[model samples]
Target chain A: MKVALVQDTPRLGDVATNLEKTVELLEEAAHRGADLALLPELFLTGYRLGDLVPEVALRLDRPGPEIERLAAVSRRIPFAVGLVEESSHHLYYNVAAWFEGGELRHVHRKCYLPTYGMFREGMDFARGDRIRTFPTPFGRAGLLICEDAWHPSAATLLALEGATLVFVLSASPLRGLGVGRHNLSIDTWVQLLTTLARFHGFPVCYVNRTGFEDGLGFGGGSFATDAAGNLLASARDIDPELLLVDVPVDRTRDMRFAYPLLRDERPELVHRELGRILGRTEETP
Target chain B: MSAPVPLPMDAPELTRQLEAFLHEEITKAGFSRAVVGVSGGLDSAVVLLLAARALGPENVLALRMPHRDSSPESLAHADLVIEKAGCPAETLEVTAPVEAAREVLGIEDPLRRGNLAARVRMIFLYDRAMARRALVVGTSNKTELLLGYSTRWGDGAYDLDPVGDLYKCQVRQLGEHLGVPREVLGKPPSADLWPGQTDEAELGFTYDDADRLLWLVVDRRVPPAEAIEQLGLERDLGRTILERMRRTQFKRALPLVCKVQARTIGIDFRYPRDWGL
Candidate 1:
């Protein structure tokens, strides 16, 4: 399956504008012949929602016009867009939703809401507690928001549950320069995505947003890696661009068979050791 | 005593990021143009070039506000930057307003007099920015800002600062990469508040020495007791650097509001600076 990494710039707290731009970029992705397209985290409503959360968030249970437009776009090319999801109650979540053939297939709410340093996610978003893989038109897939993929266990759980492809959506901010060739934030992400892909034997498609939000610039180095952690396609710089990555979805079987690392697994030892360390052996079955 | 090495940087990468920063910030603020004070110093020259590139040269208004005692080369270097950037340029004589303020306050000390001059320049820039529908771009580098070496509301007041994160040495590195005139790059760093005032002489430390210290103390978060020995710094310079950073912490932030409401503005009722933008 050919996945297009949509490195888009969403205006802060402007849903109408973001929805329009997202549709236009999705068209671009389809024109480039991508079967699946991945947008950055919070692509519909922007990343720093703060007090504007209620104003910009959408209820996905009864998807709004903003989501309906994307679902319409998905009739031809299945795509995933980052969003701020308003729950049935007043609570909100950082979410990524998959739309295929005018149906919402799966949704992944971000679990790790970073609250330190330049981030204030914990103050605004209710943390997600679920990690699972779902059936997609392309294949069984897993979706992860920016910080959720930072934890290895998030992706590993999905792999164990039978996901052949993983899409990591991000809105990572740009920071730390004057030391390396790349911005420190972008550099770290490249390494992290590669490790996740190579270890899980899945082609990882990463799409991060670009542009400045309140004087904070985001790293826009959206890219993909093979199952062996080799770079397939990359962005030009920290500006808005579209990157299309060809994923050999069916070949993941060959990859896993060649390595056979996941086959010789010992999760009981881990669950029991983790249980013993935390003094909670009750869940160690 | 340790002689601090000049900081190194990826100049091309910083320029790309900084330009994007200016473009998005200025656009978000609802302005397409910028107003900046161009003293013939390295920091302002670099800022001028960056602003010019971010918003095309025609969009940037480079103003030269010089006092009577300001060095002739200051205006000459300012001219060099304006010419090189090919941006819109203006010159202002700030001597009258500054002298008037100094006289009314009965100020005799050079430092106080210098501060008056700095504030006077700020007034002209802000007023011009208002008339031109532009935002004032700051030229204060990280080294000067960390040391609190600028007038609180004078050179420090700006709508946005593209080069604020850059230390003096890093600014120089970027300036060189952007092709700032050699004469401007080679000149001694000065505020030009008076005839012979220089930044290093007034601060009692070189930027090379202070920049590495700032990085260690602030960026790396090294303890003073440990850093002094690690860098082999002469004891007093290290002490004064930390003191300046601590004392001037108030200048870097908004004025503190008393906690009367359950959720005060700065303390708790926090929203991003780019709210609804």
Candidate 2:
């Protein structure tokens, strides 16, 4: 499957301008023969739209004209994009929507909302409790927003649910110098993505945005890895980029067969251990 | 065992990066100009130079705010910067405002007086910023910020900071590279809050020593025991630095907002300061 990852800056609270830019980038990705395109988390309204988020939040189930225009574009080349979703019940969620054939295919609301340091998503949006994989034209895939990917269980559940690929949408900032004098956050993310790809024997596409919002600077460096954990392509930090890579679908099945780690399953043991940690008695089978 | 290598800083690269960062931040914050407090100290001098370079000297306003006890050399060095940088500047004696506050509070202690002076200077800077429609660019270096040596809400309040990430030693290096006068660079670092006051004497350690130890402990995340053993930092010094960092962590963040509601400002209703403004 050919995928395009957009690493671009979004103007805060300007949904119209951001959507126009996204459409333009999606067109560019299509021109490059991409089967699917991925945009960074909150690409429509920007990640740093603090108090203005609720005002600009989109209702995906009853999307406006701007979102409808994006859905139309997705008919040409299926894409996944992130935005602030306002439900009919008036609750807000940090959501990633997969669109194909001018329709919303699957919507993955972010489960983990970061509230530490510079992030306050927990206060801004309701937490998503469910994790499920959905079928794509290329294969079954799972979607995880920025902070959700930080948890191993999030990815484990997706892989267990028969997802051959996972897409992580993020707006992570550039911080502390790493142990090897590298970009610390980017290095840590690379480690996490590669570990997930290797352990689950499935490919992972990570997308991040670039540019500064107030004092915080988002480090782009979006990337993709094969099922074997080899990096295929990456975008540059601090610049707008549309990274396109060809992911081999066959690699997932081949690697899983070769490793057989998934075949040697232990869910009952995991459940028992979790029950012990949670101080609850399990119903023994 | 090999000696621990000092962290390398590239002065030119850092200056270029900071200049661009300040320019973007200032312009993005809806201001085309910058207002900077110019002290004789290297930190202020470096910030003034960077702000001038970022927004051009014509767009930068350098303010020389001095209390009655402020060193005469401070004014002279500040004048040198104004003259060399060719930026517009003004000398405002902070004696009246500081004295007024001091008299009302009946405060004679040096620390309280110093804090008043710092805040008084900030008031002047902010007034100038508002009058000229410019953002107040900060000059606090990383060492001072990490050590929490700054007077909170006084020298710490800023719309943007160009040199906050650079350590004091790195600031000196950048200052020298930016052609700040040799006299200003040569002088012992002091806040000039009182007569015969030097930063090193007050803090009980030189910036070079503090920078090295802090680089190891904070940036390198070295264990305290290992930092002392490997970097040859005194245990007490390391402990003091760590303790100051711990105590002043609150100073670096927004005031604690008790989460009683669904969305509390600084708790859940947080957004970037530049959002929609």
Candidate 3:
């Protein structure tokens, strides 16, 4: 299956323009023969929303014109895009919602919102408390926002749920200088995402936003990897790009059978161990 | 600390990022062109060159606004940069306005005179920017910004800053790697306000020393006593840099607003400068 990994600059707090741009990009992706497309975290509203969160947020339950437009495009080519989702309870969440067959299939509110050091997501948005993989035309898949992939447990949970392909969306900032031309943050992410895909025997598609907002820049170096962790497609640094890659489902199947690491995994024992570590099972046994 | 631990230098990558920053911030602010005061020093030179690369040499307007007491070499080095970058430039002397203010106000102190000269240059740059429809970019580095060495609303004014986060030593290192002229990099650092004015002489510490001390205190977040010990610096020297940073806190922030309303700007009323952009 052909996947379009979009790394584009979202105009901060201007949902109208970004929504228009996203529609155009989706049409372009579909024209290019992509089976699916994935956009960066907060792809519609932009990251660093501060007080403008509510102003730009889309109500999922009510299905505004923007959400309806996205659903229409998803019918052309199944796609996932991130946005500031205003829940029915009137709380905001940084979310990635997948659209397919003219319907909202799955939505993942970011499980981990970084609260410190150049980030204040926790202060702005409510945390998502659940993780699940949903059925898609491509097969079982899961979505993760930027910080969610930083924790290994999140990916492990997705793997345990039998996700074959995972899309990790991010608005990661451009920072740090080491030996390479790319900043440290971009380099670190490629390594981390590649390793997780290899361990889980699943294809991981990572899409990050580009351009600066209030002096904080999000570097665009979106990439994708095969099940065996070989980089399939890589985009440029600091520019908007539509990186396309082919997901070899046969390789995923081969790797999962050849590796068989997940086949023998024991989540029940792991849960009990976690309960013991938390001191909840000390006297029960 | 420990000879500053040799700050990392990646000339190509840092150049790429800063240039990209200029393109993003400038165009986002609704201008395709930029104007920067070319002081002939490393900081301004770097800013000008990077701006040229990002916005194209034709788009950047280089201004050399020098006072009467300003060193001749300032103009000469600035010419060299303009020629090398191939950007359009104008040499507007601020001496007339500065002298007018000096005589009318009967300003006797050299310090006050220098401050007047800096602000006068700002007038020329901003006026030209307004006429040319270009945004002014600042040249102050992190060390000078932290120490509040710039005159408020004078050399400190700009629509955007590209070098504010980089330290003086890092700026010098980056300038060298990007093929900045040796004469510009080799000379002692100066503000060129007066004939004999040098930044080190006024600050009482070289950029090397200050950078090492700052890396420990600011970047590493070490306690002053511990950082001073690691740098093998005199307690007084380290203390002065720290004190200067502390004293200049006001320069780094917006004007204070006392709250009477439910929300006040910069206190409770918070939004990004890029809000709605």
Candidate 4:
């Protein structure tokens, strides 16, 4: 599958402007012959919303002009855009909307919401409880938000559900890690992604935002790595750029056979533990 | 020994009081001399001049340790500042040591190489200070300190700091009054890490804007959103500052030590500055 990563800068709280820019970038990627396009996390409303979260968040089905425009733009190539999704009953999510063939196909709510430091995700977003892998025309793909990728359990579950590719929408503030007078710990996250891709035997298409929002900087180190954890495309730091890569579906099957992590799984030790989730424990600790 | 009185931010007597306070601390700490890295940058220039004033020109040693990539202008500015401030000067070419250390550590990246240079300079300053029984005074200003802009165990490491509270721009103003060379003050600020690399060039924000915003956020106690709004800064720029605010918390704090007792170092067992007195 040929995918293009849009490392475009989104204006904070300028939903119309950001959505327009995202659509334009997606179209630009499609024009460049990409079968699919990926935009950074919270591309629709921009990442830094501070106190404007409630005002800017939109219901998942509400066209709201921005969503409709995105649907209109997705006439040919499938595209994924990050947004703050509002549901009924005041439930909000750090969400990504997958648009394919001029329609919204799937909405992936972020499972793991980060609450550390500047991020107070728990106060704003209701956690997503379901893990799903969608069967796209091109391939079986899984989607996760930024913090969700940090959890190996999510990736493992997606892989078990036969996902060959994963798209991670990240609004992770750069924290001045890579470009600073201090030691940058963001590279540690890169290693984590690499391990996840290798273990799951799935190519991870990671996209991150750029520009500063509310004094929080986004280091745009977006990249795509193959199932073997070989980096295919990398974006610049704290700058806007587009990254494109092509991977054949067969490449994943080849890697899985070579590594055989899927086949050699010790189900007796691990899968049996999963059975506890389905059981109601009578004893409380 | 009495506790330091809290001084107003812009009090005119600050310089004199600061000098006296630092001198007393140095004597009590048992250091006979003081060493300062002469970067020719405003931050270093202010600190160097302060050290000279506090502990006479003879007692303060100014070391200009430049790497191979350091600009000649930066070095020349250092010499001019030394001449103007009347402090003793020494130059240590760090290229050989840095190269050897890089080889020994197997560090190959440009970033790590720059960090190694900072650490090497610190090592030289510390060693020379130890030889002279001097303390290495830090040159970092409040802005850089707040942003965690210095490398830990590198620029962040120091025995004492005289100009740690002043912002970068404030340091320039203070340096001017201290009779620092105009050429040194006027020159574009740089760490002289790589060829033609300027501090502002790497930071992606001018020191003036960064420091001003920092004062508003940190000293003035403005919220991140309100600070950006009042400053009329771009959202991305504001976000960048907030991210730095979040990430650099470690730089402003003592290293995290796990607590195994009732009272920890920074958390509960805090003591007055003049506790023993």
Best model number under DockQ = 1
Q: Per-prediction DockQ, in order?
A: 0.68, 0.33, 0.66, 0.02
Candidate 1 vs candidate 3: the lDDT winner is 3
- Model 4, residue B252: what's the lDDT? 80
Between candidates 3 and 4, the one scoring higher on DockQ is 3
> Lowest lDDT 10-mer window, candidate 3 chain A?
A175-184
lDDT for each residue of candidate 1 in B1-277, tens digit (9 for 90 to 100): 5755545677888888898888889987799999989998889889999999999999999999988888998899899989998998999899899888888999999889988888888999999999999999999889888878899899999989988888888899899999899998997888876788888888887887788888887777888877766788888988887788899888888889999878898897766788767
lDDT of 4 by residue, A84-177 (tens): 8878877788888898878888888888888877777786678988788887777889998888988888998898878999998887664321
| Best of the candidates, TM-score | 1
Candidate 1: segments with Cα more than 4 A from true spot: A178-183, A280-285, B1-6
Show where candidate 3 strays beyond 4 Å: A279-285, B1-4
lDDT of 4 by residue, B1-277 (tens): 1122221233233355346545756764566699989987777887877778888989999999988788888888888888876888899999999999899999888778989999989899999998999998898887788778788899888877867767777777777778778888787777677778877888887776677677778767788788777777777877786688689887788878799999887765533232211
lDDT score at residue A267, model 1, on the 0-100 scale: 78
DockQ for candidate 4, C-alpha atoms = 0.02
TM match of model 3 to true structure = 0.95
Candidate 4 lDDT score at position B35:
90
What is candidate 1's lDDT per residue for A47-99, written digit by digit as tens? 87788888888998888888788889998889889989999986899999999
DockQ of 3: 0.66
Best by lDDT: 3
Higher-TM-score candidate of 1 and 3: 1
